[model samples]
Target: MTLAAALAAGAAQTQTQAQAQALAKLNVVAFAGASNLAIWAGQQQGIFARHGLEVALELTPNSRAMASDLYSGKYDLALTSVDNIVAYNEGQGEARLPGPSDFTAFFGVDDGMLSVMAAADVPDLAALRGKVVSVDAMTTGFAFVLREVLGQAGIADQVEWVAVGGGAQRLAALLEGKQAATLLNTPLDLAAEARGFRRLARGRDAVGAYQGIVAAARRGTLAAKRDQLIGFTRGFRESLVWLDANRAEAAGILTARANMPPPVAARAATALLDPERGIFRDLRIDEAGLRTVLRLRSKYAQPQKELTDIARYIDPSIRAATFG
Candidate 1:
C-alpha cells in the first residue's frame, strides 16, 4: 500500500486501540465546507486517535449559533474565520453571547479562499445592481469581504444584503435563485461554478492575504483542557502534513465525508493544496494576513474601534508546544 494508505490503516488500528482505552472526547464546531478536509482526514486517519482524542465534529448553520454554542460551553473548540472571533470579542458580532468574549485563536488554517460568486446570468459585477446578495451575518464572517469586493466594482450600494447562514446554506440560496450572489470558499466555490456561477472577484485578488479559518477556544477551556488542546494541535498539524503529501487520498476523504462529487472534491483538493493560497502547511498565523483582516474590520465594523493588537485574540502556546 502507499504510505498514506498505510498511515490510514495504521491510524484506524490506533483508533480502535484508543477506543478501548476510553479516549478524551472533544467537541468541535465549524462551518460546513471543504476547508474542513484536514479535520475530517484527521478523524478518519486516526491522527486524533493517536493523540488520544475522540473528536466529535459538527457543522454550524451560522456563525451566530456557533458563537453562542462555543461561548456557552457546548463545544470545546471551533474551526472558524478569525473575523468571527474578532467581531464577537469587539462587541461587533450580530449575536449576543452569555458572557464576555474570550475567544482565542490557537491555530491558523488558510487565507479565506473567498470569491464573489454571481449567478451565470448576472454577467459582470456591474450587472448586480438591484440584486439581492447573501451574507452569514451582516456584521461578521465574510460580510466585510462582500462589501469591499462589490464596493470596488462600483455597485456596493446597489445590492441588498440578506443574512444567510453557512456556506452550504448560501450555496443553496444561490442555486435556488433566492439570492443573486454571495461570497464562497473552496469546494463550494467550485461547486457554484459547476452550477454556472461566475466568479466576479477573488478576495485575495481584490484585498490581499487574509487569515481565514483558525482553531479557536475560550480562555477557560484552554486553561482547563491544556493537555487535550495540545493533543488536538498535534493531530491537526499531522493531518495537514498528511493532506499536503496525499492529494488523491485527501480528495477521497472530502468526497466520502463532506459529500461532494468526485470532480468537485478533486478540484477542491487541488485548490486547497495550492502552496500560496491554500491551507497553511506550517500552521502558523500569517501576520500579514491578520493585518488585512483587522484593517477591513476596522473600516467596516459598526461603532468601530481601531483594532491593532494581534496579541488580544491569539494564544500560540498550544501551537508552539506542538511544533516545538
Candidate 2:
C-alpha cells in the first residue's frame, strides 16, 4: 500500500508539470487596431505579469481569422468580438461550416467604434445618401453593424459600398478623395481627421448593442485552471479599474503605446472606455445586448437564432469573478 501510494504521488507530480507547461506562458491575441488598446495597456503595465501570467499580444486583423486560430489552439487566448463568439457557438455564419465546440468568454472589454468618415465637404451621413462608402468587412461584416449605426444617425439607406477594407484603404479613399465616405476609428480616424477627413456617426451612436471583445480560454482550460483564469481576470479588471480611476494617466499609456498624439489618444481612450461610446464599458453580458444582436440578425442575417438560445454562449464566469 505504501509503495502504491508512492507511485500515485509520482504520477500526480508528472501531471502537474504537464499542466504547468501547457498553461505557463499564455499566448494571447487581439485585433491590430485601437479597439484592442486595453490589451496593450494591461501588457505594458504588467498586469498579466503580476498575475503570474506571461502573455504575448499577437496582432491579428481579420476578426474571423483570430477566432479561428484561437479556437483551433494556435493561441491559448484571444480578445475578440462577442458577435464572433455567438456566431461561432451557434454553428452559424462561418462557424457552422466547421461545427461549434464548447468555449467560454472571460472578460468584456469595450464596444467598438465602426464609423463612417468622408471627405470634409460631404455634409452628413445623410449626404452619403447615394455616395460610396467603403468597409474592410463584407455584407454582415462590421459594415452591417454600421448600417444600424447609420440608421440611428437617421440615414441607413443613404450610403453605398466601395469595397475598401477597414484598415488602410478606408484611409486611402479619404486621402485620395476617391470615396465619398469610409468608416474608421482612431488612431486611424484621428490620423484621417488631422489629414482632413470628416466624422460621421460612430457605432456607439448607432446602436445600444456595440461590439464587445472577450478573453476566452478553451473550455478545458476553464476546468483546469479555474483559479488561474480567475486571477487573470482579476488582474485585467484591476487594469481597467485603474483606467477608470486615472483617465489622464491611462490616456498617456495608450497615447504612447499607440504612437498617437495626446489628444488623439485621449479621445480614443474616452471612446474605448465610455459605456456609450466605448465597447466594454459595461462588461456585463446582459440579456438585452444579446437580444438586440439576435433580433437584428434574424432580419438581416441568415441562420437566425433566438436570444435565449444564444444567451447560452456567454459563460459570465469572468464578470462574476470580478464582481464576486
Candidate 3:
C-alpha cells in the first residue's frame, strides 16, 4: 500500500479504538452493610455489562471515609449517604476533606432511617434527656442525625451524643443502658424491638424523605471521565428500578451476595420498596433536599457565609442525566 493510504487507514483504526475505549469499563464502591446490596444486584445481574460497560464493586467502611477516599482516587464512585456528600461538599459535619466539598451524586440507591432503639420501659426520646446516647461514627454518622432527632424531641441541648462504632456495638450499649438510646436501622431495628428495645420512631418519622446511598464520582474523576460516570449511573439506576419491580427475586440475589440470613434480608428488601424509606424515586437530585442538607450541614460546619456557601459543593449534571 502507498504510504499516504496506509497512514490514513491507521488513523481511522486508531479513532475507532479510541471510541471503544471511551465506552469501556466502570468501577464503583459501596458503603459496607447488608442494605447496600443493590450495588451487588447490579453486578450480579449484569446490568453494567448490558449497558456496554464493566463495573467493579468495592466496600468501604462508612460514608464519610468512603467519600474522602473517592476524592483521593480510591474509587470512581461511592455508595454512601447522600447527606455525607452534601456535608462534605459544604465543608461541614463530619467531613474530613479540606476546602469546600465538590462531590455530586449521580443516582439513588436506598433510603435508610435511624431509630432510637432503647431498652423497654426507658420511655420516649425525651426520657433520654440528660443521659449520654451512642452514635455509630462520632462526628459524621449518627451524631449529626441525633442532633436533629433530639431537637425534634425538644431536648437537643439536654442529651450528650457518644460513639459506639457500628450497629452491633450500639445495640450492646442500648441493651446494657450504658448509653441511653442508640441509632438502629431496619432488620436491626426490628430485631432490637424483638430484643426488648423500645422503638421510638425513625428518621423518616421525623425528617421526611432523604436518599440513603447514592452513586457519586469525585469532581476530578467526573470531569475527566464524564462518559464512564454516565454509563455507571445508567446501570445503577436500572438496577434500582429492577430491584424495586422484582423485589422477591432481587432479595434472593442480595441473600446470596450479601450472605445475610434469608429472613433478615427479606425484611430489608421490603423496606427498600416502602414508599416512606425507599430511595428509588425517579433518582433526581432534589434542590429542596440539597437545601435541607445544607441547612443541616450548616449546623455541623463552622459558621461562615451561611447556607448559600453550601451550594457551591454540589454539581448536579450527572444527577440530571440519570433522569433520562
Candidate 4:
C-alpha cells in the first residue's frame, strides 16, 4: 500500500480505539425473554457504543436476587417490573432485604408480554384452584397480576402459589408437571402454545392495562450519572426504532439469541414489534399504566396497604429530558 493510504488507515484505527476507550461503562440486569431483544440488538449493532456507553447486560433469573444485587451496587441499572421497585420500596418484597431501597423506574420498556399458560389437562382459571401456580416471586413481579386474574375469577384463595424463577424456568416446571400453571412472556409463551400447553389468559386481557418492563436505577445513581443514563435511554430508544424498521434481520437475531426455530422467531419478532402490545413507541412512563400497577399491588400486597400516588416510584424527568 502507498504511504498516504497506510497513514489514513492508521488514523482511522486510532480514532476508533479512542472512542472505545472514552465510552462510559454501565452494568445492567434484565429478565430472560424476547423483551430484551432491543438491548441485544443495540449491542450487536453498536448502538450503545455509538451513545458512548459500554453496557453489560445480564439475565437475572430471580426478582429478589435482582433486587438484592441492585441494592448492593452490583448493577448500575435494571430492566425489571415496576412492581418490584414498589414492593421493595414499601417493604413488601417477597425476599426482604435490610435497609431502605431507593430504586425507581426512569424509563419504560414494554407492556410486559405476560400470559398465563397451563398444562393441557387444566381447563381454566377455576381448574387452577387448589392446584399449584408458579411465579418469579411470591409477592413481586407478575405474581400480583396472576392473583388479580384469579381473584376476579373468584378463585384467588383456592390456588397454591410457588416461587419459580423466570419465564424459561416456569415453562420448564410446567412441562415437567412440577407446576400446573405459570406466567410466560414472548417467544417462550409462543413456544409453549406450540407444544400444546394451553394459554389460559393474557395478563392484559385479565387485568386490563398495566406497565411491564422498565429501566430502573437507584435515585443516587440517577443523580450522579444523569448524562450517561440519558445517553443509554436514547440508545435504547433508537434500538427499538431499528428493530421496527428491520424485521427480518431482527428475527434472525432473536432466532439465534433465543434458540428458537426460524418460524417461531419470525412470529416472536412480529409480536414484539406490534404497536399495540409490544415495545412502547415512545419510552414514556404511562401514568394510567402506573396507576394500574399500583392498584394491583395495593390490593394483593401483604398488609394490603393503599398505594395511590405514582410519583413515589417513578421519576419522569430523565425520560422527559432525553426524549422531549
Candidate 5:
C-alpha cells in the first residue's frame, strides 16, 4: 500500500476514536415502566448518542435505596418522584443518609400515571378494608398519595399497609395475593387489568393535581456537568417528541424493555401519549402539581412540616435553558 493511503486510513481511524470518546457518560436510576418510555426510546433511537451522551439506566428497586445511592454518588442522576426529593431535602426520608442531601429536580418527567389496583375478588376501595396494601415505604413515595386517595374515598382507616419495595415487587405481591391492593404505574396497571385485577381509582382522579417524576441530581454535579446535563435534557426532550410521533416504534421499544406483550405495550404507549395527563407535553414543572405534592406530604410525612416553597427543591434553570 502507498504511504499516502496508509496515512489517510490512520487519520480516519483516529477521528472515529475521538468522536466516540467525546460522548459524555451519565449514570441514571429510574423506575421500570412505560412512564420511562422516553429513556428507552432515547436509547433505541440513538437520541442520546446524537446529543453526545452515553447514558446508563438502571431500574430502582426501592426509593430509599435510590436516594442513598444518589447521595453517595453511586449514580449521577435519578428519575424519581418529586416527592422523594422533597422527603430527603426536608430530612424526612425513610432511609437516612449521613449528610444533608444536595439533590434538586432539574427536569419534569411525568404526572406518575398511578392507579389503585386490587385483586379480582376485591371490587372497590370499600372491599380493601381489613386487607393488606403494599407500598414502597410506609412513610414516603406514593404511599402518601395512596393515603390521600383512600381518605378521599373515606376508607383510609380500613386497610393495613406494608412496605413491599418498588412497583414491580408490589405488582408481583398483588398478583400472588400476598397483598390485597397496591399502587401501579404505566403498563403494569394495564397488565394488572389484563390479568383480572380491578382498577379502583386513578391517581389523578383520586389525589388531584400532583407532580409525578423528575430528573434529579446533586447541585454540585449540575454545576460541574452543565454541558452534559443540557445534552441529556435535549436528548430526553427529543425522545419524548419521537415517541409522540412514532407510536408503533415506541410501543415496540416498550414491549422489549418492559417484557410486555405487543397488545399490552400498545395500550401502554397510548396511555403515555395522552395529552392531558400522561407525559408532560413540555418538560416544565407544574407549580400546582408541586403544591399538591407538598399538601399530601405534609399530611403524612414524618416530622411533617409546612412545605410551601417549591423552588427550595427544584432548579428550573436547566430545564428553562434547554427547552426555551
Candidate 6:
C-alpha cells in the first residue's frame, strides 16, 4: 500500500476505536420471551449503538437469579415484572438479597399478557382442581395472577401450587405432565397453545389492567450509571417504535432471535405490536395497571400490608429526562 493511503486507513481505525470506547456499556438481563423483541431489534438495527450505548443481553433462568445478580452487581439493568420490583423492594421476594433491596423500575414494557396454559386433556379450570400448578416463585412474578384465576374458577383451594422457576422451566414441566398448568407470557404461551395446551384465561381478563415487564435497576446503579440508563431506555423506546413500523423486519427478528417458526413469529410480532393488548407504545407505566398489580399483591402476599404506593417501586426522573 502507498504511505499516504496506509496512514489514512490507520487514522480511520483509531477514530473508530475512539468512538466505540466513548459508548457506555450496559449489562442487562431479562426473562426469556418474545417480549424482548425490542431489545433484539435494537441490537440488530444498531439503535442502541446510535444512541452511544453498548448492550449485552442475557436471559435469566428465573426472577430469583435476576434479583440476586442485580443485587450483587452482576448486571447493570433488568427487564422484569414490576411485581418483582415491588416484591423485592417490600421484602416479599422469593430469594432474600444480601442487603436491603432497593430495586426500582424505570420504564414500562408491556402488560404481561400472562395466560394460564393447561394440559390438553384438562378441558377447563374445573379440570385443574386437585392438580398441580407452577409459578416462577410463590411470591413474585405472576403467582398472584394465577391464584386469582383459580379462585375465580372456584378451585383455588384444590390445586397444588409449586415454585417451578421461569417460563421456560414451567413450560417444560407442563409439557412433561409434571404440572397441570402455569402462567406463561408471549411466544411461550403461543407455543403452548400450538402444542395442544389450552389457554384457560388471560391475566388481564381475570383481573384488569396489569403492569407486566419494566426496565429496572438498583437505586445505586440508577444513580451511578444514569447516562447509560438513559441511553438504554431511549434506545428501547425507539426500538419499539421501529418494530411497529417495520412488521416484516420484526417478524424476521422474532423468527431468528426468538427461535420461532415463521408463522408463529409473525403472529408474535403482531401480538406485541397490537394497539390495545400489545406493548405500551409510549413506554410509560400505566397507573391503573400498576394499581392492579398492587391490589393483587396486597391480597395474596404473605405478611402483606396493603400496598398502594406506586412510586415505591418506580424511578421516574430518568424517563422524564430522556423523553423531555
Best by the lDDT measure: 6
Candidate 4 structure quality by residue, lDDT tens digits, 109-186: 777788989999998888997899988877875988888888889988898888889777888888889999998888
Clash counts for the predictions, in order: 0, 8, 1, 0, 0, 0
By the TM-score metric, which is better: model 4 or model 5? Answer: 5
Which prediction has more favorable lDDT, 2 or 6?
6
Between prediction 4 and prediction 6, which has the larger TM-score?
Answer: 6
Off by over 4 Å in 1: 1-21
The root-mean-square deviation over C-alpha atoms between each candidate and the true structure, in angstroms, is 5.2, 8.2, 7.6, 2.1, 2.5, 1.9
lDDT per model vs. reference: 0.89, 0.65, 0.67, 0.87, 0.87, 0.89
Model 1, position 156: C-alpha lDDT score: 86
**Candidate 3, after superposition: displacement of residue 49 in Å?**
1.8
Per-residue lDDT tens digits for candidate 3, residues 18-84, read: 7557556655666444345556777778787667676777666455567667777777777666677
Candidate numbers sorted by TM-score from highest down: 6, 5, 4, 1, 3, 2
Instruction: Write model 5 residue lDDT over 117-156, tens digit each, in one string.
Output: 9999998898888999889998775898898888887878
lDDT tens digits, residues 64-155, model 6?
99999989999999989999999988888878788889999998988998899999988989999889999998887599999998999899
Backbone clashes counted, model 3: 1
Off by over 4 Å in 6: 1-16
Number of clashing pairs, model 2?
Answer: 8
Residue 291 displacement in candidate 6 (angstroms): 1.3
Which 10-residue window of candidate 6 scores lowest in summed lDDT?
A: 30-39
Q: Can you rank all candidates by lDDT, best first? A: 6, 1, 5, 4, 3, 2
TM-score of each: 0.93, 0.77, 0.77, 0.93, 0.94, 0.94
Off by over 4 Å in 3: 1-25, 32-35, 93-100, 165-178, 186-188, 194-196, 209-212, 303-305, 309-311
- Residue lDDT tens for model 1, 1-324: 699999999999998786857889999999976447888889888899888898889999999999999999899999999999898899988787877899999989888889999899988889999999999988875898889988898988899989989999999999999999999988789999987889988988888878899999999999999999999988887888899889999889888987888998899899988887788887787788888889999999998789998888999999999888
In angstroms, what RMSD does candidate 4 have relative to the true structure? 2.1
